[model samples]
Target: MNWKDIPGLDGVESPGLLIDADAVQQNIDRMIEIVGGPDHVDRLFPHVKTHKIPEITRMQVDAGITKFKAATLSEAQMAATAGAREVLIAHQLVGPKVDRLATLIDDFPNTQFAVLVDDPHAADAINQKCGDAENPLDAYIDIDCGMHRTGILLGNPSDALRAHLDSLSGLRYAGLHVYDGHLHDPDLQVRTEKVKEILGKVARHEQQHPSPRVIVGGSPTFGIWAAETSWHCSPGTTLLWDFGYGNAHPDLPMTVAAALISRVISKPGEGKICIDLGHKSISAEMPLEKRFQFPDLPDAQPIGQSEEHLVLQTPNAASLHVGDIVIAIPRHICPTVALHSHATVVRGGRVTGERWRVTARDR
Candidate 1:
């Protein structure tokens, strides 16, 4: 559907988030096409963390997506209730959340649930919680790819842990979960090579134990994953391309679905422009390159940020006046989306409708 068809574009309040429905749908279509168009063999479990809105998730479901990759138990439950048949909790379910985990399993009987774990203690906890049940919980051993954030270290010794989990009756080994956030690095060749290396290791592991399926891939690496002859890819960011990926792969069909629609709150002195959205809205974690594809407008750089303000410096500061809405694309889509509660659907420079509650925001 086009943006003009949406309900409240022209009247949307300034400093709110706007999601281009056309762009978002295109992002979903492009990612599905890149991943072999959602046949049973090839699964596209979008990480709900990128766009937590259940409406967006429903948009994907309407397009024939049944599985989802969630970052937390709450997201999984939300997705399941929204008609997502399979939910993979990409993060480890540990700490004191055993009751929460059990609650999810009991609540979503029709839904297939899985979680990732790098520690035996976590596996033991999950196994203990779901062990005697008629249905066992699926568990994927997260392997540490190039990024050291999560996952078990890849290679020889990790196989022992997998074997131990295999002995547990309450837990069924699902597969390997590898998130290549490090591959989102600007260097194209470096990212490609890293993904290839990680996938190769995963393939070798699969050759040894073929029961649990191998799932790998993230938003930035989705295109690179399309050419893979083996392994499954879980791509989330493609659903909502941000400034960082847009700068890297401009040719990709996905558009900036979520933009911080901020008005020029302040324009003090030469070459400086301030907006109402700051670290609280758009994330400052991802760095921006000085160069940009958009013409006329100077490279927007985040010089400083506070709770409710983004301090940016641009060359054409004189061209921008206070009260003009500047659509600022975020560097990273996940955290940036988590900061906002609703996104206005816009088309042709006007707000069309409102999509409330990006469902997967919390936990």
Candidate 2:
């Protein structure tokens, strides 16, 4: 359906988000094809954190996705409620919210739940809680490949800690969770080599333990991940597509499916055009100036941005005026999406429909 076919495009407000459903579907199909063929459905577990909306998750499920990778308990719950049979909490579940994890485990009885643990203390807590339950909880050893953010070091895959957890009757050793956050590096060659090296270490660890039911890998390293390294690939941004990934591989099947639609709120000076979207609406973490592919206006540059404003400078800024709507593709999709509540699904230059409740907003 085209954007003009939607019910509320004319009267709807600006400084909002627009999602191209057609583009999104194409992306899903492309990624599925890349991982293997239709028969390899279990091999692709799209991360739900990218497009937190359940409707989108359902779409992915209908497309033969049984497994999902979520960053939080909320995301896991959302995916479960939306019909995801298997869900992986790609991060550690700690703190007083342990009850929440238990509640989810009780609620989604048929669903398989697994959480990543890099420390023995965290694993003990999870094991203690699950020990009392009838069904055991699945746990993965998150390895710190290169991104020193969450996982255990390569040399110390926390084997001793994993063994400790194995001794507990409540927790089952699922597999490895290796995410190369650094692989999205600007240099394609460097990123590819790093991913290969990291996955090689994971391969070695897997050989030693040989019994993990699931081997998972996150990040948009689809082009780099060896076909045999991972049993399932969890790529979030690859589904939605974004300016950051677009910059590195222009020909990638995924398009900028979502864009921050804003109107020219002000024209401060010659060659300077300001919009109403800023850090609050669009993500300032990646910065649009460093990322955006403006085929329509090649010379336009994001000079500065604030909480609710975007300053753009260009030689042809004189052509722009107030009330003119401008669609700014975000540098990063995850955080940029969190800033808005809903997204207008568009196609062929018109609003075809609307997707409400960008769901995974809660901390």
Candidate 3:
């Protein structure tokens, strides 16, 4: 089935997110299969940052995925409300976020929410705000394996930081949070070796002080981390596969579950057409040509884009007319999903009249 085609797409609006419900379920099942099987679902803590909708979170919970990783307090709340057994706010908390997290914990008693801390002072701040909560707040020490983005170096210094966390009176030292998002080598062997090297350092640190639970990997190195039976895996973009990860890692055979629904607005010139999918509709982080892919018009070249319009030069533009539906798969689905408040659901080649709200799009 060409999951991109929507049989009853006329009812759907342009410049909005279109989600294939069946494809999303297929992706969920495939993720469970990749991490072993239903019995091994515990090893999968898929990140909820990709699709912030609570309905998708509920689908994962129904698939036996208990834990989830989130990037914001709102996302954590959405997961907890969606019946997630545990939710980890991967970002460190400061200022009003600390208190907001405390409230979230209090509100969601059934869900155990955790946060990341890379410094001792930050740990103290978290404790001060959440120490007296009904449930003991779970905290993970963010360790930098290789990506110098936002973690403490993995060595004696990380050991010392863990010691400081363990000493905190209110916070429970959950484990280590190592996110190697920067590692995305196309060669599986090369990527696997680099992951093993990072884990080797982690294993050495565990020799003296072992972490109770270790969460590692993003969508790029999810397969590598899944092999390590002891650690948990967190892969976000795999839920809604995009051109960015799909093109880079061909080994991961996940389905593209979401696409941008656009319509041709005009025939500007010879072999040139305009669409409403500007930077606002799709994620513009990648290069102009790399931002989106037209499955039907494979040769469509994005010549120009602005806040409200995207001009493309396609050989088939002469055959196309205004109001023709055009579907595009975004290079980065995560941020594109955030641009819309809701997404129209498509199943069995037709619109299901169901819209999943991007409930956690705000900060």
Candidate 4:
């Protein structure tokens, strides 16, 4: 989109992260609407790892989000400080991270903290630590429904592992947590079918040994899980959607909340101009076309990128000159948000004086 079209970024410097508060609120409301509103918002454990800012967490909490899932100790700390009723560190913490988490549990007594455990050895170590400190820890077996990454397989062997973990001291066995990020089909029905397949496995597991909760979904299939089942849904990218999710799933009613404000720095050749933004400004994880897209400059195509320069080849290149600002929406908002240290907050289509720290960026 054009710089003029985006609110609160009239005079902002180039290569900056601009966040629309109104758009974020709309995304949150959309999630709530999908998950059955306030009474069931707790079932939506929206991951805070997407936006590490405590202010955003507060906005979510004020909007009736009671549970959160974070991938780092820093994000979990922010969630706990935001007065979340429960926070799950969905990643395994090792070395210093473990100690920091222990401190977090002690410091934030009001927030019940949990961690994902796939290895019995790590569970033993954590159990030893928490048992020594006399502070019991809540643990969930990260079940691997399909993704071969961390987590025990969802069958017989897992039952034995769950029983072993429950027997361990200072480690309370909660339900299961699965991140089905691989289920990203353009067709909503295909996504829903995959969710149902996973849900069936989850149902059988719950029946054999009922845990207090089971958190599933990872942005793509959150709504599917919500529709077919009552389990907790964990969708982070919906908060600050990008072209990747929005373009793939048009049915999900979410707005683009995060955008990169950049300026043209040079006009080197015919039909070509370079922007201040590059791989450093946005996420490089996606494919070339999906990295970042300029909605307003539809003819402007990202030809190449480096650390600090995004070369654009467009027919309208001659219409632009040096110092012309443009807005770019990331194809993947989560990692793109991590690339910045601060976010420029805009409210009601007006720029606010406040700048929010991507508090957990370093962590």
Candidate 5:
């Protein structure tokens, strides 16, 4: 059996997520390697939003990755519970989440928790929530490089926000969190140049503000930031590589560790077959055809998908019978992992019957 193929896949349930433990370990090694080595492991602050499994967090912790970046409060809490020394909730907190952040800080005294603040309103809110605590919450200024998704703009806006944060009673200015997720050009040279440009702007801002630390880049620019010794690199998708990233970023040698198990449910027509896999199981953010890939039926065309059914048009569909198992590699693994409560663990090309819960899957 191929390394990607599960040995006892027939025994496993359909429309389930499968995690290759060996491949995960290999990817972890590759991540540490990209960031230099064991000596430079402290520079690796991996994002926990990808896997969302506390077991994987523990694996990273055991491998000497003490720091983590999370997109949600639950992810941050899961990382803290998994023995992370430091966990940063990378998203800006709002609503009653401010109180939750305070509670998380109080709940995990051993772990240092930080969050991103792009405005004074957010800073003051955090201050009001946890200002009087014995240890105030550490805050990082989220700089919007070009994504414009979050973070303050590079120049006056960021400077003003920094000064405002200094005046806040609760949130302390720790550093800058620059995520250039927008610089995902297929060409490494193009991406590198873009990263350099973003860093140049950040350098000028840091010169004025004197930030103590900095965390930069996601999976696309991971290698570039890894070369920069001063900045911390947070790449989440490297843990469980997906077809979307792997195909676009061939320079990254990370393996696709996660896959989906589905079975033929019906033969609707001569050239069409329906599978148990559907939008509810895998991440459907991409186009219908690009959502998942069938290694067994490489030429399979994903014609339609419903809540619990995916119809495929493939000449090879005639060869497959009802109840026959098929494996699919998700193009987007993060949200796909969240759709499932647990992932069936595979080791050495065999199903281990052990399942790892997606601990922080829910917001």
Candidate 6:
């Protein structure tokens, strides 16, 4: 679709992922400013999996942000190649993936790389692979602060494990990696309390070791660490705010940066309209209301969704027909961004005739 040709957004076409460049830049600036100032941009090890685009990473690098966090080897390689001084593979690598990670470090000797480790066996695999490459790997202790998804439990004798890893060859202790993925309470006070309680646990763990560079926060609880000079905050989604957090945390000093520009396709029935936006177009993990927000059609409700069809029922259904375009703010912008191969760039209320590729997708 020729997005630039359309004078009005209604003609931009269906299932189009439109990204606001101005808003993204604003977000980048605010993020840097929040965690101290532009001078302290290096303190943020931003997770790049949210918007898997090289353009975004380069924007950050150009603005003097050095450190980055990634979920997969592909993202780590992308960040390193994009001129990041340090890249942290926030997710653990095991078996053959360990060597691939080691090779990434070998491939880009200029860029320092580290991975998170919760298990000694996984650490052994990574260290052995790095040993084969005549290099010692840096590793962070993944401490579970509440999110049981990954990382070692805080009470699992993590200090002993930390001691054991320090003795192992071909590996250096980077720091403690604490991700409170579960601390996203809508109430700022509640979130703040939860953050302090969990971060206190992280602090105690650090006291035992004395100096493990603590990396914490996800988009929600970043404010807790924003003023904290010692803590390296890793807030990825804050770079591109979504409705999921935005709707909940109205007090979070950030704007809705990314959006999905989808056009209406068919009127399935009375008061029901079917848009081309399927579950594939945006993130379907959250509930209906939390998945997407429609500013144009306030009453628009996602009644059903499939691969290529999004059935909606709204009070203003009669106002929209086939080919009428609408803007949707995804509740979860991360997966929605990953859904598109490229984002149609818009600036000053006009298409810039450029596309930002979603580089490290599904890897």
Model 3 stretches with alpha carbons more than 4 Å out: none
Pairs that clash in candidate 5: none
| Model 4: lDDT of residue 185 | 95
Off by over 4 Å in 6: 1-13, 132-134
Q: Tell how far residue 4 is off in model 4, in angstroms.
A: 3.0
Give each model a TM-score: 0.87, 0.91, 0.97, 0.96, 0.97, 0.93
Cα-lDDT of candidate 4: 0.84
**Cα lDDT for residue 260, candidate 2:** 66
Q: Write one digit per residue (lDDT tens) for candidate 1, span 1-363.
A: 333233554466655676777777888888778777657424676788777778788888888888888888778878888888889888887766666878887888888888888888888998987665456788888888878888778766467778878888888778778778776666767777887887777777667666457777777787777667445668777877776787876645677776666678898768998878756776656553431112234477667777788767888788888876665556677777787877876655556554577666777
How displaced is residue 48 in candidate 3, in Å? 0.5
N/CA/C clash count, model 3? 0
Candidate 6 per-residue lDDT, tens place, 222-277, comes to 87767543689998988788877887887767877677887788898999998888
Backbone-clash count (model 6): 0
Candidate 4: tens digits of C-alpha lDDT, residues 1-363: 244575556678879998888888888898998989888787889999888888888888889998999998888888888879999999977677777777887899899999899888788877866643355678988888887777889877678778878788788888788889788999988888888888888898789788888889888887888888888999998888888888898978888888888989999899999999988888898777768778778878888999999999999899898998877888888888888889988887777877888988767
Name the better of 4 and 6 by lDDT. Answer: 4
Q: Determine which window of 10 residues in candidate 2 has minimal summed lDDT.
A: 1-10
RMSD for each of the candidates: 3.3, 2.7, 1.3, 1.6, 1.3, 2.7
Q: lDDT, candidate 2, residue 330?
A: 75
The TM-score measured for candidate 5 stands at 0.97
Model 1 TM-score (2 dp): 0.87
